[model samples]
Target: MPQIAILQMCSGIDPDANLAVIEDAAKQCAEQGALALFTPEMSLLLDRDRARARAWIESDGPSEMIDRISEIAAKQHLEIAIGSMPVATAGGKWANRSHYFRPDLAPPITYDKIHMFDVALATGEAWRESAAYEPGRAVVTVEDTPVGRLGLSICYDMRFPALYEALGNRRCDCIAVPAAFTVPTGRAHWHTLLRARAIEASAFVIAPAQVGHHADGRETFGHSLVVDPWGEVLLDMGGDASGLAFCEIDLNRIAEVRAQVPALANRRPIPKS
Candidate 1:
């Protein structure tokens, strides 16, 4: 069993200010005895302006946020999972990337977000993420620290259950979904979807979220949560400012839940019409 912490952030346009907040949250989580700490999407910057956001993105290795967080993780001897950042990738498009860093590694194990939010919301808020970012091709599951086999995903990916199913098939014990969910959608579907995913996959779900208003006037639903395999809410930081939420996850509980429910084994294919 390992203890994990989720950092709920209300990020503004300033990268420096956001980093300072994240640093403080990480330290607090570490002090609370959390072995691994996770952050929300666009953990460093939440700029809606395309040109300005593009300007802040870096090409090769780590960004200032990554380096700083890595240093902090090293100092605290904690494993850090950054939800997602905008990074320069091939084809002149940026990637919405999630990175996992251990105390020993200078670089991180990265996973680009596979699902892009390219729809017109009911509120008439249209987002073509593919216009600004490229999509990741593969599902990523990695092993490091107190939790054994952890799967990584970004915001919009939460709508796709098959992705999580794939991870579960690959034996992922825990899943992280760092999000900046719109207020309307989050209010309706956020908690239910997270709980369903946790129950279906028999894995602990770590969801660090962006709360409050962003510089772009986008209101994010901020109920950052950590749910267990049995659909229990371990920690819930209810739409607060910047905060840390912790949960002790027993890896063996995954097996226990799956054994009781046996839902994973019951999933069978039906013939297409």
Candidate 2:
């Protein structure tokens, strides 16, 4: 069993400030025997000032936060699951990427977010994420951890069940869902979507999220969750402060649930013209 720590944050415009908080959280979680720590989307900076945020963003290289987290992992002998961070690409667009830093301090495994959130909500707020973020073409899974084979997904990717199905086919035992969900949509579909994915894939679902208001003046619905293979809510960190939530993972539960349910084996293709 691997002990996982999910961290919530209301990140601001400053990457250094955000990293300070994350460093402390990492130490605390490491001290508590957590093998891995998962952080939320935009864990580096959530600046409302897009231009300023871009000024500070780096492309395909190590940021100060990334370096710090890698050092933490090396020193603490911990594995880290970094949520979504905007990585500048050569095409002048950014990619929402999740990074897996192992204890060995070697090159990290990364997954670019496949889905982008571009919505005009009824609440009178609009976001066009595609303008800045490029959607990835590949689905990534990493298997070199103590926990189990891990599938990576960002916020909007959770809305697509086909992605989870693919991960299921890949025999991944756990999935990371790091999000900075809007208040309205998060309230309506957060738990439902997460639970459904867990049941469909029969994998442990770990979600760390942004809470409260950000430097961008946008509010996020927290409630970071750790769900078991049987669709049980093992831990739910409420939507208030930024902190770490802990849970122990049982790979046996994944096999146990799949043995009884057999959803993946029961799949049938739909004929299309």
All candidates' lDDT scores? 0.86, 0.87
| Candidate 1 per-residue lDDT over residues 71-178, each given as its tens digit | 888988889888988888768899999999888757988999999999898889887999989999999998755788899999899899999999878778889999
| 229: Cα error in model 1, Å | 0.9
lDDT of 2 by residue, 1-273 (tens): 778888999988878788788888889877999999999988987865668777777632336657777898898888988897778887879888888998887877899999889999999988888988889989899896767999999998999999999998888899999999999999999999999999999998999999998877899999999888889999899998888878899889998999999988898887998
RMSD of each: 1.7, 1.4
> Native-vs-model 2 lDDT?
0.87
Model 2: how far residue 240 lies from native, Å: 1.5
Cα shift from native, residue 104, model 1 (Å) = 0.8
Q: How far is 168's C-alpha from truth in model 1 (Å)?
A: 0.8
Q: List the residue pairs that clash in candidate 2.
A: 48-216
**By summed lDDT, which 10 consecutive residues of candidate 1 come out lowest?**
55-64
Where does candidate 2 stray beyond 4 Å?
59-62
